[model samples]
Target: MPGPDLKRILARATSDDDVALSETYVWDLASLFSYSPSASQAFALSFTRRFGRTKSWRVAVKCLHLLHRLLRTLPSDHPFHSHLLRSHANAIISLNPCHFRCTSDELTIFVRSYALFLDEALFCLQVTKDPSLPPPETFAKKVEEVDQAVELVSQLQGLLDRAMDCRPLATAGRSSIVRSAMKHIIRDSFMWYATLWPRLMLVLDNLFQMPHRLCIAGLDIYTSAAEQAGRLEEYYDWCKRMSLCGPYEYPLVEKIPQIQVRAMESLVENMWQLTDSSSSSSPVTFSSSPSTLTVSESGSSNCVETLKNAAINVEWEKFEEEEKPLIQFGQECADWEDLLEASVDCSWTWAPLIFDEPKERSQNNGDNGLRKHEANLQEYNPFLDHAHPHAM
Candidate 1:
C-alpha cells in the first residue's frame, strides 16, 4: 500500500493541468517501485497506469500523441519542447528495451521507437514553421538525425521480423489508440514529406542524396529490379514497409486516390513555401514558456546523477547531438546548447540493442547509410568518442 506521500506524488503527476511536472513525478514514482515488483505491479494496476496502458491505452498513447500536441503548441525557439521530446523518447525507448538475444516478442519496443521517430519529424516540421528557427542549411542537418533513427529502426524490423510473424505492434492490437495513431502517422508523414522535400531541394544540390530521396522507409524511387514501378507503385511499396509504423493498416490499393491527392497537394503547397522563402523579408515569431526541467538551473549533482541513472533518464549530450540540427534550421531559433550548458540538460536516450541490418534490405540494396556509419564509428574521434570528466 502507498503512503500519504505516495498518494500526493501520484495525484500531482496525473493532473492534466500541469503535464510537464507530471513527467518528473511519474518518473520518480516509476523508479520508486522498480525494486518492488509487487508494488510496481500493484501501482501499475491502480486503475490509472493499468487503464492508461491496457483498458484504454490513452495514457500510454499520450506518451506519443500528447507530446505531439504539446510540441505543436510551442514555438520552435522554445527550448523546453525539445527537452520534452528527449524525455519522452527516453521513456518510450525504456518501455521496449532489447538485448541482442531477445526473442521476437521483444521487438515491440523497437517498433515503438520507430513510430516515435516519425513523430519527432512531425514535431520538427510543426515547430520549424516558426520564423525564429535557423536557416535552411542547418535545418538540412536534421535529415541526418532522422536517417540515423530510421537506420536503427530498420535494423530492428529486419532481423526480428525475419523469422517471426509478428504483426508490427501486435502487442497493443487490442488498443484502438494504436489504430488512431497510425492514421495520425500517415497524415503527418505526408505533411512532413510535402514540407521537407522542397526545402531540401532548394538548398541542397542534386548530387546530394536523401537516404531514399523523399521516402521515409528508404524505398528506392528508381530500382532496376522493379522496372515497371511508377510513382504510385513506389509510394505504395514504401508504405508497405512501414507496416508496423503505427497501429493502422497500410494505406494501399483502395486508399491510393485519396493519398495521391493529399500528397500531391501537400507537395505543391511546400513548393509555394519554398518560392515564398526568398521573397519574405520578415517571418512571424513566437516563444514558449519554459518547463521546470528546462529552466536553465541546476540542482545537486548527486540528485542529478540519480535522475540520470534512473531508468527514465536520458543522456543530455547524445540527445543534444541528435536534436541540434532540428533547431539549427533558421537563424532566429533558440540557442539550446548555451541555455542548458551547466548541466547536460537532457539527451535522447535510445534502447541499448543495436542491429547489424534493417528489418528488410531497402530496395536501394545499399544498406542505406548504416554500413558507412558502422565503418566510421570504428575510427576513434577524440571529440565525440571521449567521455567528459564532468559527465563522469
Candidate 2:
C-alpha cells in the first residue's frame, strides 16, 4: 500500500543488484516517516511485506541496513519502531527462519546469521522502549534488575557473535555491498559489544559485593563473561582480517583487558571458597590445653598461661618436620607488586583505553593541544626528564 515514491525508494533500497544501501535513501525513508502518521504506517507495512519475501542475500542485507538505520536514526518514541516491534511480535515479519533462497552456503550462513542479528537489534529496541527496565549503570542494584540487564547484555553479545559469523568469503569480501555491510557491522559491534562489556563487568563487580547472592546462583556469571570476552577478541580479530585497521582512520578498537577478567575470576573463586568455608564451619572449638590452662587466672599469670597454652596447642610435629619457616617476604613482595601493576594498568576507565605503546603514541600525538601543553610543561620544569633522579 505504499505510494509510488515510497515504492520506488523501497525497490531501489532492496534491489538484487550488488550495491550498498544509500544513506540518502535511508534518510529519505526517515523523512517520509516524519511526513505524517499514515505515511509512516504505510511504508512500514510495505517494507515488512517486501522484507518477508526477500529471496536474495543482497536484498535481505540491504533491507536490514535500512531498518537498522531507521531504528537508529529515529527517536525512541517514533511510531516506526513501535510498528516494527508490533509487526515482529505479531509474526507479521518474523526472522526466526531466514529462508533467503540463496544457492551459496556462505551466503546462506551470512543471511541467516545477519537475520538473527537484526532480530536481536529489534529486541534491543524493545528493551530500550520499555521504561521499566533499569539503566545499565544501576541495573545491578537488585537481583531481578540484574537478571534483566544480564539478559539484555547477553542478547547484545549474541548479536555481536552473529555479526562475527556473517563474515564474507574472500570473493564476496571484495564486493562493495559486502564491505559496506561489514563497516556497519563494525560500528554496531563497537557501539553495542564494546559498551556492553564494561557494563557486564560492572554487574559482576556489584554482584560480588553480596557474597550470599553470588554464592546462590552467580558462578556462571564469571565464566560467561570470560567466554564472551574471548568472543569479543575474536571479533576484533575479524575486524583486522577485514582490513578495517588504518593508521589515520581505523585504529583497532579498545576492548576489556583479559587480565582484568582473570583477576576477577581469581577473586570470585577465592570469595566462593571463603563463603563456602564460612557456611560449612562447625560449632566445636579447639582446646588449648588438657589441664594446665584454665579459663580464669591473675593478670600476670594469665598472660603467662596464655603463652603456655598457645605453645601447648602448637603442632610441634609439623614444625619439627619442616626445615625452615613458611614465610617468604621476597616472593610475597613480588606477588604484591605484580597485582598492583595489573590493577593500575587495567582498571576500568570510561575514557578511551589503549593498551599498546604503538597505539598509545597515536592517542597522545593525535591531540595537537595536548602535545603543545606537554611541551610547555617540559619547558617550565628543567628536570622533567623521565630518567632524571630529581624528576617527579
Candidate 3:
C-alpha cells in the first residue's frame, strides 16, 4: 500500500478541480521516490490503478502532468527513471487505453492533443537522450551527418506541432492547469526553435555536397523547416491570447535567408544546364580496326518520334464478367465400424479412473447436502459458472 502522503498528493493532483499543480507536491513526490524502494513500487501500482479508472480528460491530463514533472525534476541516476523504464517495458504504464472525455468537444480535443505531447515527452525522457549529428569530416560522412540532422529537425518540428495543438479554444475557459501546462510547452517550443535553426543551417551548408537527387531532397527539407518557422508568431500570439505568457515576450521569427535560396536555385539551374548540354551534343561513335559501331542521333530521334506518334489499340479481358466455377465437395457417409477402425484412440488409458460417478448424497450428511445443493444450483443457473460455488 502507498503511504498516506502519496495517496493524498495523488488524489489532489488528479482531482477535477481547475487549478494548477502545486510545486510543493512535485518535490514531495520526488522525495517519496528517493525515500525508499518500496515507495516507488507503491506509487507505480497506485498511479496505474488510478489512471486506469479515470474517464475524464482533465484527470488524465493532470496525471500526465504530474508524471512529467517528476521525470523532469528527478536526477538522471535516480531509481525512478529505471523503475519507469521497466514499467513501460512491461506495459504497466500504457497510454494505449487513454480515452479522455469531457462535456465540451473543444476541450476534449485540446486534452487529447496535450495528452499526446506529454506521451512523447515521457518517451523521450525514458528511451533516449539527446542524439546529435556527428562532426562533419569526409564528403560521405558530412552528407550522412546532415541527413541525420535533417531527420531530427523534422521530428522536432512535428513535436512542436503537437505542442502547439495543445490550445484552449476561444469557447473554452482558461483554466489555471491549462495555462500551467502551456507555459511548459511554450518554453519547450522555444528550446526546439533554437535547436531547429542550427540544424536547418547545417542542412543548407551541406546541400550542394549531396548527389543531384539528394540535393533536391535536402532543399525540400530546408523549405519545410522555413515554412514551419514562419508559423512561430501565430503560436506565440495564441499563447498570449490564452494569457499563458505574462511579462515575457516570445522571440521574433527568423526570415529565411535569401542567399541560401538563391544558392539552391543556382545549383539546380547549373545541373539542368549541364544535362541539356550533354544531351544536345553529337552522338558518340565507337570504332575498332575489325568493325566500327556508330549511333545515328537523327535516326534515333525519328525512331522515338515514330514510337510516340503510333497508337495501338489494346483490349483487356474482363475476368469479372465470366462466371467462376464453384467448388463442390463430395459428402461420403461412413459407417461407425469403418470410422472406429481408422480412428486411433487419443484418450488416456486411465481416463475412467479420473472420471467421477454421479452418486446420490444423503441429506443426513452436511457436506453431501451442500454439494448436492451446489450441483442443483449450478445446473439451473448458467450465469453461476464463474461464481464461487461456496459463496451460496
How does candidate 1 score on lDDT?
Answer: 0.38
Q: Give the per-residue lDDT digits (tens) of candidate 3, residues 1-392.
A: 44888899899888887777778889888877776767776777778888777876667667877887887789768888788777767878776445767687877777777767766665542213233635545656765666676776777777788777776686554667767777877877777777777777666555434455555666776666667665767878777776766646577777765444544454344433345343332333433222232334323324222212221100011222343323224635666765575454433223455754455433347687789999898788867855756655
How do these models rank on lDDT, best leading?
Answer: 3, 2, 1
Once model 3 is optimally superposed onto the true structure by TM-score, how far is the C-alpha of residue 21 displaced, in angstroms? Answer: 0.7
**lDDT of each model, Cα atoms only?**
0.38, 0.63, 0.64
Off by over 4 Å in 2: 125-149, 211-218, 245-392
TM-score of every candidate:
0.28, 0.59, 0.59
Please write out the lDDT profile of model 2 over residues 1-392, one tens digit for every residue.
34887889999888899778889998888888787566676676777788777677788778877877787889879888888778778777777777776777776677677777778778773444343445445323444555555666667667777777777765767767777877777777767755565546544534443434442334455456556666666766766766764423332444444444443443344444444455431221223333332221122234323434444334343345553433446655556667666656653324787676577776877798678998898878766675576756
Report the lDDT tens digits of candidate 1 across residue range 10-100. 5454343313333455455544444433443333234234223432223444444434433344455554344434544555323333222
Model 3: pairs clashing at backbone N, Cα or C within 3 Å: none
Q: Which ten-residue region of model 2 has the weakest summed lDDT?
A: 292-301
Enumerate residue pairs that collide in model 2: none
* Global Cα lDDT for candidate 2: 0.63
